[model samples]
Target: MNIREYRAFFLDTLSKAYDAAEAESLFYICLEELKGWKKVDLAMNSNAELDRVELVKWNEVLTQLEQERPIQYIFGNAHFYGLEFFVDENTLIPRPETEELVEWIINENKGKKDIKILDIGTGSGCIAITLAKNLPQAKVYAIDVSKDALAKARGNAVRNEADVTFIEKDILVADSLPESFDVIVSNPPYVRNLEKQEIKNNVLQYEPHLALFVDDNDPLLFYRKIAKLGDRSLTGNGKIYFEINQYLGPQTVTMLQEEGYKNVILKKDIYGNDRMVSCDV
Candidate 1:
């Protein structure tokens, strides 16, 4: 089919499952990924034809989208904090809110030198690696419980040329770090398992459960554990940052303060919802 006909067909197929804007965005995303063509390129050349082999591959992606697969997973990569990183079912897709947390850290320490940062549950290494790249003098370390997740994180570090130490360790059992850090951050699993019904099928069915869900009875399990770790792991004037559950912001801040972290601050995302917290040791 020609570019115009193919675009219309693809949009119509996805319109039933997604909004017009989303469908169009996905169309352009897939087009660029598959053929190195943008919306403008297609608009300028309406009669452009797809190669038979490329057409088949594009159809497979369309089928997955119709089945509610996340586009990021389908593409096998995503952009976060101005860098591209590999992603898969084993890792949680990096969210924009987490990018704000990274921004906060970067802005707060813009001129600081030789800082040490630790990222817990570093899926895809977005947080730690971004920090290392943005702050060239910073020493960054990331830890994850899953070997599969750590492997992807390591790949991201290599791809981004961001020097980071990846460690295979569980934060739940740790009382102190091997050494103190200047700043510690985490975007841990804070989604309550009971809230699964509220999650979209695209995420519930495809994303890693270990990186997304927490026990419903104690949704703050990771918060408590990581807060305790920060208490022991942070340097005397170190700061702890987290991408928190919006619904449990108050409780998250309470956990940090109760754990002896001072200057705790809860900040909202661009949408003006409670989304992140930072505390001083």
Candidate 2:
């Protein structure tokens, strides 16, 4: 079919699954992914017919999108912290809020050299690799419980050309984390069971739950564990960062203070949600 027809099909089919504006956006994204054509090219060559092979691939992606699968997963890649990383169902897609958290860590530790950084529960290695790329002088390590996720993370490290050490270990059950870390950051499981209904279907259906959830009775379980680990593992003036649940910001801050973390600060994301917290050991 022609480019205009394909674009219309994208918007029409995706509209059934997504909002109008979002469907429109995904159309452009998928168009680029399928044809390597910019929007300008599509607009200028509106009536140009797509070759059968290209049409087939575009149809496959459209079918997946109609099924409510995330576009990033369909494309097998995502952008975060100004870098691209491979993604699959094994890894939670790197998010914009997490980018903000990375930016915060980079800004907080700018000009530091030869420092050690550990990323707990590093699903896609986005946090660790971005830090290593930006702070070229720092040593970066990432850990994940899932072997599959670690494999993908390792591949992502290579794809991004950022040197990072990856480990497969469940932090929740680990004896101890990497020691003497100048910075420790985790965007661990924080979604409570009680909040499951609030999750979008695309996420609940496709994203891995191990990286997304915690028990409602103990919603801050990962945070508490990571903070305690940081208390024991962080170096002098070591800092701990977390992308926390908005509802539990105060309690997370309290937990950090109780764990003997000083200078505890909870910061909001662009959306004004209490999404990040940091403290020094």
Candidate 3:
């Protein structure tokens, strides 16, 4: 089939699942891989064609996208903070809101030197690698419970050329964390079981639930453990950063305050969701 015809087919199939703009976006992303054609190629040559074998491979990709499979997973690559990271079923896809948290950490420690940072639940190593790349003067360590997830994170750190120490451990089962940290940041599983309805089908079907969910009865389970750990782990004037659940921002802030963390602040993502919280000892 020709480029134009294949584009039409791709758009029609994905439009049923996504909005017109999103569908078109996905369509061109497919063309870039299938035909090595840029967006301008579609506009410049509407009648480009493909061989039968090429069409078959393209068909498989479109079939997955039609099934609400994430494009990043299909491509095995995702961009975060202007760098590309490998992604797959083993790791959660990096999101833009998390980029904001990374940016905040970079901004918060722009001129600081020789500090230590720990990233709890560092799925895909997005936060840890970004911090390590930006703050070369700091020691960055990341821990995740899932070996599969840690494998992906370690690969990403190498690809990004960031120096990060990846540890395989479950924070929930641990009694205490290592001390002497100047900053601790985490974007742990905050989505309650009751909040599953709010998640889109693509995520619910394809993303790793271990990195996305928490107990319904105690939604703040991970946060409480991390907060208590931070209280014990951080040095004087050490800061803590969390990407929190929008539904429980106030409670999260209150919990941090009760843990003796001062200057607690809750902030929203670009989408206006209550997404980030910061506090210091």
Candidate 4:
């Protein structure tokens, strides 16, 4: 089949499962990946013919997209903070909002010397690896409860050429972090059970629930535990950051304030949702 013919079919079929914009975006992504053809190339060579093998590959991608599989998962990597990290069902795909949390941390602490940073519930090591890559003088450590998740995170650290220590430990059951940190950050499981309906089928079916949900009775479970751990684990003047649930922003800030953290700030993401909270211990 020719490139132009397949492009029409791809968008027309995929749009049944995804919105028009998303379907179009996926079309170009696949075009580049399969044909090494950029948008300009596609425009100039719309009549380029696809061989039998290339056609098979495109059909496979189309089938997966129709099933609502995340394009990142289908491609085996996700772009975050200008780096690509491997992702699987064991890890939640990195979100842009979490990039804002990472940006805030880097902007706040980039000038300090020989600082230590710990990322709790590090899924794909996106936050930790990005920080290590950006702040060369900082020591970065990341911990995850799932060994499978940690394996992928460690590979991502190496893949990105960032120095990061990965540990397999459940923060909720741990006594304290291995060492005091200049900064502690987490994008932990904060979505309440009641909010499950708000999640899309693509996420609810494919993403790891272990990294996504909190019980209805204790939506702040990880936040509370991490805050308490930060009490002893954080250095004086140290700060803690969290990518919080949008609906629970004020409540999260209040909880941190009640925990004796100072400078509790609830910040919004690009979408104007209160998505990040940071405080000093």
Candidate 5:
């Protein structure tokens, strides 16, 4: 089938499961991947035909999409901060909000020299590596409890050519970091287990539970642990940054303040929900 006909069929098939816009975008992404053609090429060469092999591959991707599989997982790579990183079930797919958190850190510490940055629960090493890449003079270190996650993070460091030290250590453990850092940041597992029902099935079912859930009774477990660690591991005038649960923003800031982190600030996201918190040590 030609590109135009296949795109229409693909969209029609997926529209039953997803909205028109998402379905169209998914179809176009697959087309670009399989045919090595961009949207401009599609517009100019609508008559371009797909060979038998290409058609089979396209159909396979379509089948996966119909089953609600994420296109990023299907492609095995995702774009973040203008860089591509490999992704899989071992790590959570990096989100745009997390990118915003990175931006906040970069902008807040733009001209600082020899800044020591530590990223706790650095899945795919996106935050740590992005900071390292953007701030070349900074020392970046990342830690994750799961070795599988750390392995992927290490690979991402190499892939991005960012010098990030990946360590396999649980952040909840008190004696993890041997030395202090200038900035500590994390996008830890803050989703309370009870909130599973509120999340889309595509995420709750497909994403790694280890990287997503915290006990409802102690939803702040990771936050508290990281806060204590940050207090112990930060240099004088150092800062702590967290991507927090919107529902628990004030509580999170209060927790950090009680732990002796001063100047606790809660920053709202684009949706006007409390999303990020930063504290000075």
Candidate 6:
């Protein structure tokens, strides 16, 4: 069948799972990745026929989408801070809110010299790689507990041509860092089990759970441990940043203050939800 015919079928098949507008968007994204055809190309070549192999690939993607697999996972790539990184079942797809966190860090320390930055739980190394690429003088390091995740993160650092040191260590059990850092940042697992209903099925089903969830009884498990680590590892003027759960913003800020951090500040994302916090050592 031709492009136009297949487009109609794709939208209709996805209608039950996604709204018309979202279905349209997903259809175009799939077409661009699977066949290198954009909207204008589709408009100009509406009658262009799909060969048997191409049709089969499209059908497979359609099946996956119906199964609620993320499109980024299907294509094995996701864009973050203007760079594309490889993603799979091993890593969580990068989100736009996390881009804001990256931007906030870059804005605060754009031209510093010889600064060291550490990203804890750097599942895909999105934060560390972006910092290295944007701040050429800064030394960036990333840590993740999962070897599979770290392997992909290392590959991403090479793909982006951003020099970063990837370490395999679990922060909860570690007593000290390898060295001090001017800045420490994390977007760790903050979603509580009680809030699982708020998460979309595609995320809850397809993304790595170890990277998405925390215990409902102690949701700040990572924050508490990382804060303790920062207390010992931060340079005298070092600052720490976190992308937090909106529901626990005030609690996170209070925890930092109790840990003796100064200038504790909670900031909101574009959606105006309290999503980020920062403080000094």
State the lDDT of candidate 5 residue by residue for 125-223, as single tens digits: 999999999999899988888888888888888999999988888778657585689999999998997788899866877889998999989989998
lDDT by residue for model 2 (154-248), tens: 99889889999998888888778856799998999999988989998889999999999899889988888888777778888799889999999
Stretches off by above 4 angstroms in model 4 are none
Query: Global CA lDDT of candidate 3, please?
Result: 0.90
lDDT of each: 0.90, 0.89, 0.90, 0.93, 0.88, 0.95
Candidate 1 pairs with clashing backbones: none
Per-model TM against the reference:
0.97, 0.97, 0.97, 0.99, 0.97, 0.99
Q: For candidate 4, lDDT tens digit of each residue in 216-276?
A: 8989999999999999989998999999999998889889999999989889999999999
Per-residue alpha-carbon lDDT of candidate 6 for residues 254-277, written as tens digits (9 for 90 to 100):
999999999999999999999999
Residue pairs in clash, model 4: none
lDDT winner among the candidates?
6
Clashes of 5: 0
Model 3: per-residue lDDT, tens digit, 49-111?
Answer: 788899889889989999999999999988899888898987899999999989999999988
Name model 1 segments beyond 4 Å from true. Answer: none
Task: State which candidate, 2 or 6, has the greater TM-score.
Answer: 6
lDDT of 1 at 134: 92
